[model samples]
Target: MYKKLLLLLLFFKCFAGFAETIRTDVLVVGGGASGVAAAIQSARSKIKTILIEPGPWLGGSMTSGGMCILEGNRTLASGIYAEFKNHIRELYKPRLGYDTTTNAPLVFEPYTGAAILKRITDTVKNLTVKMNTPFTAVKKDGTGWEITIMQSGKAVTIKAKLVVDATELGDVAAAAGVLLTAGFDSRTDTKEELAPQNATNQIQDISYLAILKDYGRGIDRTIPQPAGYDATQYACLNNADIKKMLASAKLPNDKYLINWSDCANQYPITSDDLNPENREATFKKAKLRTLGLIYYLQTRLGFKNLGLTDDFKTTDHLPYLPLIRENRRAAGMVRMVLDDIYTPYTRGSQLYRTSIAVGDALPGQHYSIPGAPHINYPPFPAYSIPLGAVVVKEQENLLVTEKAMSVTHLVNSSISYPSVQMTLGQGVGATAAYCIFFETTTKNLKPRIIQGEILDFKGMLMPFADIKTTDRDYRAIQQIGATGLLQGIQKPNGNSARVLFMPDSVVHTAEIKPFLNEIYSRAFLWFNKEKPGELFTIGNLLSYISEMTLRDPKNLQDGIQKTWKTYYKFTTGFDATRPVTRREFAVLANRFFNPFARKVDMSGKFIN
Candidate 1:
């Protein structure tokens, strides 16, 4: 009887140790800001999605990296990023005295930020999050991918129809034989004036950020001197004022984010440090530098109360991951460059039509490393990110987000911010869902269908500064802007610039005639009957719509006039003789002609 009981126990233990294979419609192989957004959006689209993270927490740089202070894109909130911002505001506003103003930078504790992300992710249906799970290997199987991940000391295989490579170093993409480029690009290679003359293996400096908290004036929370501590190494901070420096990144709960560069805490990394074998040791060195900085602040600066916070809940009290600014960039269908942001309207490729994400942040780069090339680019206006930028060139069923997407080294500075990355992740999720629903490959996907999905989810297709999400006609304006039927005016605002779509401005025949003629064949015949350089009146717009949609002008006019004041809420009465505003034309044209419904190729060219 004893031997039989022991055999039963042994059999149960053996059965529990067997590895399991899970099937999912989408698999996101990172729990960073972008990965979380991608998984949430993918699941929100009613697809079964799985998100795996090596770390214990979500929001990679925003929380685990101790970069809780968000910068740029103060007004361009959309999709998951907007949801994240709202969650932070709601969680901290009443209790923590957090700033809820529009233009104020978002500041919060690292742990609180991570919690907020987890809360938002928990409410999403069809999404499964696996923490402490590290990606092991990836292989292309049929039209989908078969990925191996380590969970609970066992290998778990996930067969996914679509895969999003949101890893910090693009490890999943690299393992799947995707073409990736690292380091800087030469001016001749990228054709950018601001790029270096020659390419180099050197990348941007990595910051192992530390979060310090004020534990009152009388307490002594100063830590012991870290190993290899040198006073001269931190001589740069000697002359700086302590009060001003600490206020630079002050958080809601008396916490401060120490990601400054004046003290030289930013550590330089080489291509070799990016290797998995060397990465751990490289991170140890960076952490030591941060610890040394913290010690310098406490002992030397006489701030004994400001000590390392237990926000991360780690033994060392340091952030879980260092703030990596650049990483392996995938070579996608189109490589975005500086010229794309500077001149999107008249560019060689009309990528605006294929836009899936919008970013308005100013471009910046950190060159703290020795002998690193520094080239300052002129201020650029808000621009749209193309769908092809995230679609890998070699892989048909794979997509990449965050810093791994296809953009030149120079263009990465603008698109790599947390908000922009989150929006891009949302776009990637919608694109993957569209492909799955249509049962088509990434190469065969149309831009308009994906753009429609983004709009359906209230995601911005164009970065129009003046347009707000609350505006009733926001979707129509964004759709028309994406089609290049209307272009936003780029105006300089202080150091940065913004693209404004002045909807109240009256439309001119010449300004829109060219685009109209290019998009619609009947537009040419209609323009032949109208005079050049004339104001595009409501009567003329109705005539044009009638010619394009082959509808009776009287019926179209009667329907618009009845709904103008009540349903459409147009303040101005429908007068055929009066000149039409951009807003009115966009709404009416969007309803009748539906120019945005036209199919566009990857290059944003209209398909015949």
Candidate 2:
């Protein structure tokens, strides 16, 4: 009996060794655009990283889905996404004669974009790219995670400290049992201007995109008729609404993106496409619908010569995957709503301190249910993406990227764009690295620390053209603006009144009184009696800072005097009537944050 028990122990130990094991500091699942960025950033930080992509290629919708044409302006694209665009320009500059000086090389072929991603990721020393591998299961192994992935019909186990769900559909989040929501949210649920009264399990229709080759003139290139092809099913193709949508969907290189409003293959009715039960059948139906759309374009619209391009060779002429607009969004620590984008953050709010990523894409219209209210998002300025939106609400050691992020359906439409997704990915990667470096959880890591890391990578937490890098108090001013303490008050500038943060502009008592009241809750009632156009004084600035920070006015004054005596040689008596310039206010503000500083610089004294 003793011999038999020893043999049993040996057998179990041997089995454990036989199983494949891979270890890394960060394991990013789903090699989509965000996943690729996350893996690159994490590995570049010197962490052992493993990136698993189910598809053979990288660049999710940005590449395989044939979304090569970049969206948003050059100001919006920064960090890794900007680097990727620059690399693409380098690859095609000789071939296409695109000007390297300008940021106009936003368009590229599908294969070229994918190849660029592959080549760039291959150069990272600590990153391991596992192609054609899908995440099967994940469980908490102590404070970390042990993930099971299926690669070539064999299961491989990977142990990692951090896991990011960069899947286009939030697969890893679901597998980890993270709190998630799907479909449309009600007005009561999110208080959004356009959300319906009652929530519904309906999402924006996904498109099976096809890149068409423009073979100028006429030539017979009609594809075989798709199964169950019907003529009456697409009577709305000629409608005015569809014609406008088609015009917007047109791409360069004589190619037309076929997914348009009220026409072709946009599946409006919500079905089991996201449900695991009927996923396969739903995918087939979607593919057939696209094929039918092509037939309509050729036979009905009289474009017989236009043939489908063989860009995605793996999936015939169509893209390797469908362009999914919405999915199960993980409930994060901070859920981003329309207000966060359309309006500015309130002063002294936590949201202001945590702004990490920035995006400028306008929200796209949602057409999940027929006859649903077609809500439109008004044009807004570029906004910051808070770190709370990426950290999972309840789950530990996990972060979500792409459409799975914590945002309302309306905000999702804007952030779902590949460029924005990459920004969020880079932020997440940096946050993950910080968490690993500091030996802290995502919940415990502060946003300011993460923001510092993002800035180090040349990321734009706030990408305003007016905010230059050379500003003396750039970081402090950015922090203030981020908190919505002082928004750009619109002033007339000839033809248009553009809102701008004129940092050099002096602040008057009238402008600062209302903000002080908002922050201090009417603590200093005497400020209401100040004269109009009176310049904010040094004494007023000190009192306001002391009150805002809940410090005793006399104590703060004494500390400031003592610090000034230690730092400066020619300090006389305190002057209360001296007008405080913007630069002086910045110095006082900086000192307020770091009261223990032994030395103070006065370079900003010349600033208005």
Candidate 3:
């Protein structure tokens, strides 16, 4: 360990001159779902961009990290998130001629996800994605950022006008001196009803997910046993209810993800933790811990029949990715607080002003469990991610991405999914384009301007509806509400006569499928393209948009019409011939917009 530390120190000392400094319109760190979208958006905008990922492969959750299962509303997705799934569907399905039962074009594989990221980056000139590059530090240089990165034992530098920290953990922002809070800060501090009464520093333990393929009939395939398997020490999640039912041979849903299945703290560290100060040691520690997890599952539990597969395991069970849970968040113009989540009271949210993308999902797990290893799905309030959430408080040029953006612990629990993370990435990308076009700095932009830009961006809309009109923040609220970007709920007095907009009420993607499709149908008409009368696969449209947006960043408008047109033209192959797909106006849910984008309704269809 001493030798490794000394070697690292020496390497840093000698690598000064080797640090290459370049300039770009945007700098995206971390190549996960959000980072990929951020890079794609910036590159598509024709803006110079540099993307750095610590791992050799892309797709932090899907590839190196082994998070293949996409959570949240798959169909509610409109931008990069939609495109990724669509590509997986089209690329994998066009060859197979049939989709897997999940209705996803095909089940995703890690490498395929990685290659798709590479393909998008390679196709865009403005985007330059580098593998095995870990960010070391970030400095605010008055104009933008001076970011230092390490690769191949050398330091490289980038002077970026905008920086997106899509790292699974908020490494850059924390290093850059953003005011960061970890774990549960407390209800008094966070103003969250759900905040634990007692404050704690223990962030939820990151999950090391394993992909198990069941061949049906209780027959386990010859997948290999994971490395360092021991026969006497493994333990599964041990859910009492599941254990009782296990006698009947059934496993509950949560346990399948291996919640508390093993004690993973014993694994060794194999890489840097992406922290400049001690990432190498931290990462090496992570490796041993991960190995311990796999060991417990195989030999310790006597799952002799269970084996590992390199095809999925990728260089042992040590996920090439880190399951990060927290990061530094900029104190943006408007912090979406826990108070905003109550369905009974909150409304006229200033969030309506700066929302670029939006979503609603429940925060899943808490760190400390009351019993037996863990607890099942716990419910929290639904919420939206506004544009201000990703912009740093003082930085005039940068936008955050993925797990790096601002979110109180309450909402962070919900927005951390790879799909949602990708949505935020796309929103940041479009915003970067807007920032470039307007020659404006991110910090200088307001909610209205940001809203306008997003409405005109290239991705599809998450459903939103404005429950109120003629209010001071009407323009902002209506921008989302008119197009059904947010949802309208009962009035505070429980009277339906006067509707109140409960912007804080959490709405899941699953609840808004009808609204999503309605918006898509309108999108078809607005783009003057053919809308296949049949159930159109969301992926086809997503791919076309991604394919184009990856090249043209400003189709960046999210006004329902522009978004619809972009997707419609991309999907129907507009030969200037196809009966119009819509004849009437459509209204989407004010229920919930994917918490990441601010969309526009252009067909004069959704303006409330």
Q: Which candidate is the best by lDDT?
A: 1
lDDT digits (tens) for residues 1-608 of candidate 2: 99999999999888875567877889999888888998988888777889999887899987878777665534456678878888887776785444455435377777888899899899999899998888888998877899999978988899999899999888888888887887779999998777888887778887777888768776878999989888776777755453455455555466666655455677664634676666667767778888888888789877787789877885458898887878788999878887776555442233534677777665666473467667754445566788888889888879999889998877787788888888778888888888888988876766666777776776656645465444545565555554444555544434223335666566677665664454445545646544434887767877767655779988887777676545532134456666665545555665574321211111101111
**Model 3 alpha-carbon miss at residue 221, Å:** 10
Q: Is candidate 1 or candidate 2 better by TM-score?
A: 1
After superposition on all C-alphas, the RMSD of every candidate to the true structure, in Å, is 2.9, 7.3, 13.6
Residue-level lDDT tens digits of model 3 in 345-372: 2344435334566554445454432331
Candidate 1 vs candidate 3, lDDT winner: 1
Full ranking by TM-score = 1, 2, 3
Poorly placed runs, candidate 3 (over 4 Å): 1-19, 94-107, 151-153, 212-293, 300-302, 312-317, 342-345, 366-383, 452-461, 464-608
lDDT accuracy of residue 133 in candidate 1:
95
TM-scores across all candidates?
Answer: 0.95, 0.80, 0.65
Error of 1 at 500 (Å): 1.2
Candidate 2 Cα errors over 4 Å, as ranges: 1-19, 92-105, 239-254, 269-272, 347-350, 366-369, 463-465, 468-477, 483-485, 488-608
Alpha carbon lDDT of each predicted model: 0.86, 0.72, 0.54
- Pairs that clash in candidate 2: 582-608
